[model samples]
Target: MTWITEFAPTTEGLNACIDCGLCLPTCPTYRLTGDESASPRGRIAAMRAVDRGLMPVDDRFAGVMDLCLQCLACETACPSLVPFGKLMEGARAEIAAHRPDTATIGKRVLFGRLVGFRPALVFLSWLLAIAQRLRLTDVLPSSAAKAAALRPVPIPVPSTAGHEWLPEGEQVGTVAFLSGCVMDQWYSDVHVAVIEVLRTAGYRVVAPPNQTCCGAMAAHEGAAYDAARMAERNVAAFAGHDLVFVDSAGCSAHMKDYDQWTEGGSDLAVRVVDATEFIAGLIAKGALPAAVETTEPIAIQDPCHLRHAQGIIEEPRAILRAAGLEPVEIDPTGMCCGAAGAYQLSHPDISDELGRMKASQIVATGLPRVASANPGCEMQLKTFLDDGVEVVHPVEVYWKAINTRPVRQAWRALKTVPRRN
Candidate 1:
């Protein structure tokens, strides 16, 4: 303990680990490798050593950190309640500042630019979607292939199509939506479903005229300057909204943490809210619009961020039940579907393995279909889904349940879907 004097992690709050190793079993990377070095505890140690100047941040160190899913399961498991998420972000930031290499350079380029701008991000997604449909991925190398496979078939952003604003029926509240980078292009259906549900619930939803990416990609990858700038821009863009809702867990986590990201900087930290937080608060207040019945038994996978990061374990399920679904629990404590950010692509073997296990767990529940609140879990579950299994976001299912009159059309949407169960 004496060795720790000056250069602790800039992410702050790393001393909470206490070397308890309580988080190892819960971490997917730790479970797969059976190496403590891959666990949160070991990573913290490496981070500590690097901070103390006893070790240089080298290729091996980056590899260890890279292997992490950043799922935040470890944070939930800790009794001392360390902020491992921030620590990891800081560790990455430190790495990014000093070790700009060929390996991470492309990511810094792609994700940095994607979250930093809206027009190019949307256009790139459209191209990727076209490429997917055209089978154009065949020409790509292994690295690019990995990126494409993890991505959903991209779709058109509704905003550029035109300002499809929600009805103005004496707004009960105002909400700004985070049409995230990948979520915008690949999982447009989920975003659309969220909007539909919000509008139906009687609130005027606004896609903030000046809003941009939520900066999650850059933040996680350690592009601090770029991520901070994105945050600052969002803080300015989202000035007057009553609440900000982000459906993607990755984005939700980042948005909620904007207060932390700009602890001493931005003044808009108080405005950020995860989509579920807003939706749940709406439901609790009885401001939400009433919906129809969905008697179908629905299985739910709580994304680690939705569950562990924001303490939003019950809102998605509550909305499901309130909307008339059976609300079956796939895992009461919730488990990762193994799609931790870029995990499914980076470590396909382990990602697939964890996803298969989760898929099996969902299937075993004997539920007709599964629902998750986050787009990543939905996509991950869909990738290995066997026959008789269907995946959806919670908002999609909830919206479909409104009214015994039976809506003329299904409310939910997805890209590259095979067929409905």
Candidate 2:
């Protein structure tokens, strides 16, 4: 009945918690439920007990662990620099090793077989888009309807795979792009924006068709095997490129920790950078043109992965400022919007409550447009926020600002190299 594996939490991470109570205020579940079992400290305590054989790894323990948003806000607040995110993933992997229920089985299939396969994911997205257009989701059960509603209007995925975009005049450097699973299928426009912005910054962008999912969702759900396989594939796909740019916050954070998943991953992990972070660096170098005009204020909703996990809080804001947009902070506490990957679909009730809370904070800012780096957060905000509110990636906003300038457009037209396979 023991479920301990190499993926289970380590004693070092468990013992690192000093019971400081600092993480209590940062945990969304604890703040919402006011339960000790919901907070990071409490969860660590349970993990310790399970590690020591004092507590059984039963359904109750799994429930407690699953309740967490795994947003890693607590890790940001922890002075000890505890690897809580890693520990949590390990614990979940252990639980998944022992628990093989209907839900877990479904997740395995979804993350392993479907999300890992780009074509299958694209086809599924097409089906979802059609279903949404036909209003067929309304007829599904409540849970299924909620899942279906998460999909944004699907756009044609640009032909970027196996192709490269060369910057005009002089290429600064070459960087690989991760056209992620859901990102490529549902939010392909963001990829286009990222590539355009990067190209504008004088970097050659390459989309390797061999790259697959970053395995963030699988790792989050305890499918470590699938995640490791993905890490290996990505490491090989993006090999020889010194820098790899990822547009999705979740994928960026996960890829940054690829070393933890597979050997040779550290080589890829060290090179992975968030697209916004890369753009911010380019702005600092004055490689990109200055903004000709300023836009209206936008509410900046920090995705948990970007703000907390990667410690990339100011880069996106700097990019917005460089693009001549006023960036408004929605929540200083860095609370989760409840869209923790597929967390919204699995825990819709808690997800909705947190989504409403985040949406309210954004609405209070009174900004018509919101910049969120992650697709999940953007979708969650779109679902809960008013119809007048707009959610877009920061790079998308930057692309718009630069693309609208006449001189820049002229320069782009002359300098932009055609896509080459």
Best by lDDT: 2
* Per-prediction TM-score: 0.85, 0.93
Residue pairs that clash (backbone atoms under 3 angstroms), model 1: 291-402, 291-403, 292-401, 292-402, 292-403
TM-score leader: 2
Candidate 1, 264-284: lDDT as tens digits: 324465666777777777777
Candidate 1 stretches greater than 4 Å from native: 1-8, 135-157, 160-164, 263-267, 289-294, 403-421
Clashes of 2: 0
* Pairs in steric clash, model 2: none
Across 1-421, the per-residue lDDT of candidate 2 in tens digits comes to: 2546777888888999999999999999998899999999999999999888888888989999999999999999999888999999998888888888888878878886689987787688778878778888768885465545454555553335678889755787899989888787677788888888887778888889898999999999888888889999999999999999999999999999999998899999999999878888887776676564556688999999999999998988887887789889888888999989778777889998999999999999988888999988987888788779888788888888778768587756655657579
lDDT of 1 at 41: 94
